[model samples]
Target: MHRSGSTTHSLFLSPQHPHSERTKRRPGLSAFLCFLAVLAVSLSPVPGAAADHRRPAPPPAVTAEGLRVLPAVAPVMSCGDVTGVDLRRAAGAEVTITSAVVVSENTPNPYCEVRGTIAPANTIVVQLPLEGWTQRYLQTGCGGLCGNASINYGQAAECPVVEDGTVASATTDMGHQGQNDGSWAAGNPQAQIDFAYRGVHVTALTAKALITKFYGRSPAYSYFTGCSDGGREALMEAQRFPDDFDGIAAGAPANNMAVQNTYHHAWNVLANKDADGNDILLAGKLPLIHDAVLTACDTLDGLADGVLDDPRACGFDPASLICAAGQDPAACLSAAEADVVRKLHDGAVDDKGRRLEPEISHEWGSELAWTLFVPVAQGDPVSSEQFALSYLRYLADPNNPRPDFELTDLEFTKEAFWETMQSSSYMSAMDPDLGAFKRSGGKLLLWHGWNDHHISPQSTLAYYDAVRGTMGKHAVNDFARLFMFPGVEHCSGGEGPDSFDVLTPVMAWVESGRAPASIIASKIETADDGAETVSRTRPVYPYPAVARYDGSGSTDDAANFASYTPKREIGPDYKWLGSRLYSSDYQTWCRAEGTELVCGQHRGGRNWLSREAGR
Candidate 1:
């Protein structure tokens, strides 16, 4: 997977390069000096003091018509004393406390870090603030195979509770400690069950138990946030465990796992190969395709901002990029290369042209990130090849593992497509019925990058449309919203403002009953001296509405933009072989029984072989 190292900065426009009249006013020298003096006093460490127990002031309230603020609670137990508390029987699963100590190094505030493992093998780490605890619990999702215990708060950079370290946070390694490859699931039914949905549920329960024990009260609000595979985990929570979190932010989710790995990713690589087994399209021609796409579609939204606001409306054909006779081969693609490019963008298709996955394979502006599937050198394996091969060998068919499966063995026909989706209910999270979550007052904020290289942005759109179809549009609108970042890639980083705070809007929506109208996303550039400054700002609106530039102000300023409905409407349900999986009837509940895992309808007498063969 690709990643960006850009530091998340303040959302406000920079004073050095003011964009409009709405830019924040710069502070005078006297006021700045006074603020620095106050900050120095507050941060100054006490001599011979073991710990600093002072709490920082909470941020301003979000005022609205029906605003309800979640209260903050102080810790009742000392940081060091937390290590002595026993919870072997308190948590639903058997628990072990490996270590508990107060940590203040390289953090905004002091907190007690608790590291432990749950029953079987679910490693978890929880952080409880020693002071200024806002009765809120946040659990982050993991990416890839999620075999390492870690916590990331990048998605919540704008939330004051996370920025000030006033919120309790925790994360888990799913189950089994191994490399990101699917080998962790081979011959292990319990670990597969844990990774599918049980791991997150158990971890949430255990973390809340610890928070209550340390604070003498349960948290008032809880939230979950993640992107990529983490995004899949976020949706799994909403579908499987509706009562777990009050709010969820899922970004570029990989929810349709079975088809994504078996066909979508495999097709990305196989489609680019010629009959001679030579690579048809190389990495060098990506820029040529991307530039052509921008020239054709960048201004579709009434602004020339190097991004396509709605790529589905862009009808750029790859045949136009085909090289003419005696033209420079270095600058243009050959006919064969152009066809390969067309196949990649068209997504996985059967002999009759039916889609294997939903919608387009990859968006137009995302050609640059196609390096994930396109190889720079002949005979070199791409990232998608490895991802697909791994899943096929281990996680695809849990009951009948194919440890020696190769990428060449995959088939893309209608029959083969149904074969791949036989066990989809086990790992995929494409369930569209979120009625339980909506009834529980849980708000879902779904976002995806239009230029994501790994997962197609259209997949997210397909799922969102399915949700709206399952639940009435008006009912879904009150509890769910989708924001599509124009030029952003998988999770973050691309040609647009990729850094934004989704947590703040979700928190406001969950606690104050105020739905988000728009979110400000920023692109921060870091200088050589470690100083950070905002270079660009844009306001992204909910789906079906896009940011339109006011003709008078700078296009770089968010204040110069307003949400406008698009002229074209998104299509109905995607024409895919696995589209039936979107229905609730395809959902399955699995549990480990001795050495075998049983699913619904065939649990009593039928075995995995008979069920799969009959399908």
Candidate 2:
């Protein structure tokens, strides 16, 4: 996907509504029909049917489910049909589709476009160019595993895997199905292990193969981009298959899967009460809180701008919104209810002294409760939530499942930091070793939002610091760049500014080798219906130091945020959580410094985010 020229714009909208549409089942092909069709019987053999076929004379009956794959030249097995699509004008480049290629014999999953050309010399190709077109991979919003649950455009749970013949793209179902990634590899630990290991290995092989088939040669450069769980995936690739992509863009990755789920369960528990013991506020309150928050914090950027330029600097308090006596029974949170927000925003701890992690934002709970998260107070019976709890359960145990999201202060203890979560524990600190990726002469563009309620932007800084800490700071700085957005939530919706394609500079850094010192992040404008409306831009600092806006020129200009130097020197200050990444015992020494300052280990370590958006 190429960016439009300056003053031009493009918007990609996914049309499929999250799972609300009822699916009609089609009667599958008949088993008897296969016996009469000679070609179908020969090529569509079921798995493990080799011995039977090798017999002096194969059995007369053949089944699609019993087919074994052999090399294309092995026999005259029936070749699938293919279709060609005209994409030259579609991509605005000399793009071509040889034909739709169906990789499977039992199921006719046809996909067209053997290659895509962003420019005359650029082509993202694929192997197995077909003779016809059909759907290559099913799409879903469920991250990791595609759960039966559905979401919408405002809240994209996940993006289904599309084998649309790019240079290389992948979806694992995370080893299970029903998710945007189709991580069809859940429940089975072996699948998880493979997903963590061989999954990347196999995918790299497939991508290389596709690059060869489409461009007549393998790709000299490749990249990966994803947010939340996708962030986890990006890191997974770097750790397990670092050589595949030259650069990667991961946003708020859900690394420590196990504990994150536990934390979500716990947060949902905390969010349960209304002033009256009987009346409970539902998940719908999240957006309400989010809107209120943006209203209060958006102007902090000094432009009356509807974006939050610095969440850390904003002093708005949740207590300010508490319901006054008799202010419409259930409309607003009571003082007690507000306390929930405070402790939740602060983080959770159980009666046993164990602490449950908090959502990236206090407002994340209210929004996700109804907007995207699993609700316990609802008939569903899960407790505790903070956004990512559902994905964790869906990927780890799609067949059975966790007890929804049960919450207990006892479960939320000091020991519960992040290291203990069986599923999402490592998520908060999944910085991979990029020594090889950097040594290969590659460059990376990493960014996140500071106010991100989902995966905290702090996680991004932690990962970057790990790279800088391990490799020389200047060395990592040579090929890697980091951007932090101040108030963006999850990805897009926040009070601070939120418009601008962060990818352009990344592409520039990779292809042109013009290392980026910083990037300009923007938010929407009041009259943003026009194309060039993404006119606002803010300079983002590299690290340690921050971009402070100078009250001059248009606040919309990136030059307004004067660049400052990083304060944290390239030295040793970070610490691993323990044998586990989120271990309570392993101290950042920062957290030990206590939450007196804007940052420290106890405050949960390195704080970072994409330009104007929060990580």
What TM-score does candidate 1 reach? Answer: 0.87
Instruction: For each candidate, give its TM-score against the true structure.
Output: 0.87, 0.59
What's the residue-level lDDT of 50 in candidate 1?
35
- Clashing residue pairs in candidate 1 (N, C-alpha, C atoms within 3 angstroms): none
Give the per-residue lDDT digits (tens) of candidate 2, residues 1-615: 111111111121000112122111112212221221211111222222236555654443321222111111111112222223333333223333333333433222332223222222222323332332111111111244322222111111111111122122333332223333323333343333333333333334443443334334444445556566556666665653455566566566665554444554445454554444232445555555656666776665455654554454455577777878868735677676566656555444556533343223343223332333334355444423433345444433333445353333324444444324332322333544577667665556566766565555545665676667667788887877776666566666665444434433443355444455555455544445433334455666656556666877787666557776545443223333222253222222210012111112333433212111121
Per-residue lDDT of 441 in model 1? 87
Poorly placed runs, candidate 2 (over 4 Å): 1-175, 179-187, 194-197, 274-303, 320-333, 352-355, 358-410, 413-432, 470-472, 524-532, 565-615
Model number with the top TM-score: 1
lDDT minimum window of 10 residues, candidate 2: 6-15
